[model samples]
Target chain A: EAGVAQSPRYKIIEKRQSVAFWCNPISGHATLYWYQQILGQGPKLLIQFQNNGVVDDSQLPKDRFSAERLKGVDSTLKIQPAKLEDSAVYLCASSLFIGGAVKQQFFGPGTRLTVL
Target chain B: DQQVKQNSPSLSVQEGRISILNCDYTNSMFDYFLWYKKYPAEGPTFLISISSIKDKNEDGRFTVFLNKSAKHLSLHIVPSQPGDSAVYFCAAGGGTGTASKLTFGTGTRLQVTL
Candidate 1:
């Protein structure tokens, strides 16, 4: 089976620019997630969606970051007015929902964003 | 405040030896812990996991030990191979009133030499 898929594996933009990343999760998976991983650090959860509805986004930077999952399959994460500090890898993950919540998650090749 | 922490930035082990990576979490609510191995330019792959109710879980060459009272866990790989060299991350999850959200630690880079 194919794993989660992400677009534009690498991206470079100037500070204050807007950038977007896309993700297509595994078929039949009911949960999708977006995470940010700074160099030398683990991926941090940014937002999570279950069937086209947000399940959690408490760590999302509401002032600049936004995400959406359409039809419970594909997702997009956007960062407007990106800052140099935002230079990190954006990872997308998906998992099959079981017994009310997802267990193990399968990750995608992340999009590495660099803000100059 | 980081909830999960992998204190060792890197570790080196000779092939055929054992490689142990450690992790500690500050939150007591975490009941499920997982370890992921990642290679350069690729996404992390789940290695092994242990639930709080269990103290140890093993899969072939990899074993995970959980010490719930201390809020600590460790991943052990036996007969480490060259292909096992990668950054290993430990993640924790489980809480109330929320979907299971993972909190990961900074990774520990493992180097296995032949």
Candidate 2:
């Protein structure tokens, strides 16, 4: 099976500008997630989607960030008025489900966003 | 607040030696622990994992030890190879059954030299 797919491996934008990143998870996976990883840090969960519905997004920066998983298949994460602090790698991942005999998460090559 | 932590920012080990990476978590509710290895420019790959009920889990050359009483865990790589050099991250998964969400720690970069 093909791994999770993401578009535009890298992006550079000016501060206060808007940008978007896209991800297509592995087929048959029921859970999708978006995470941010700053340099030298671990990936931080931004939002999680269990199919077409959201499971958790408590850690998401609501004021500036928003995400959507249309048709419960692919997902897109957007950041408006990007801040310098938002410069980090955005990763998208998927799992078969939150509850099951399998619990491993498969990750895609992340989109590295650099805000000037 | 940082709930999970990997205090060591980096570690260097000689090839064929033992490489031990440590992690500590502050939450007792975390019952499932996992280790992921990430190479540059690539996403992380799951290495090994252990449930709270067990103390050790092994996979090929990698082993993970969990100490529930201490809220600590360690990943040991035996006969460490240069290819094993990568950033290692430890994650503590919450709850039982299906609701377990993972809280990850700051990664530790490991460098193995020949």
For each candidate, how many residue pairs have backbone atoms clashing (under 3 Å)?
Answer: 0, 0
Scanning candidate 1 chain A in windows of ten residues, the lowest lDDT window is A95-104
Model 2 spans with C-alpha error above 4 angstroms: A98-102, B97-100
| Ten residues in sequence with the least summed lDDT for candidate 1 chain B | B92-101
Q: Which candidate number maximizes lDDT? A: 1
Best-performing candidate as measured by DockQ: 1
**For model 1, what is the alpha-carbon lDDT of residue A97?**
61
What are the runs in model 1 whose C-alpha is more than 4 Å off? A99-101, B96-99
lDDT, candidate 1, B1-114, per-residue tens: 989999999999999999999999999888888899999999999998877889999999999999988889999999899999999999998673123689899999999999
Q: What TM-score number comes out for model 1?
A: 0.97
lDDT, candidate 1, at B72: 91
**CA lDDT, every prediction?**
0.92, 0.91
A1-116: candidate 2 lDDT, tens digit per residue = 99999988999999999999999999999889999999988999999998889989999999999999999999999999899999999999898854364477888989999999
Query: What would the per-residue lDDT of candidate 2 be over residues B1-114, giving only the tens digit for each residue?
Result: 788899999999999999999999998888888899999989988898898889999999999999888989999999899999999999888875232477889999999999
Candidate 1 C-alpha lDDT tens digits along A1-116: 99999999999999999999999999999889999999988999999898899998999999999999888899999999899999999999998867765568899999999999
True interface contacts reproduced by each model, as a fraction?
0.67, 0.52
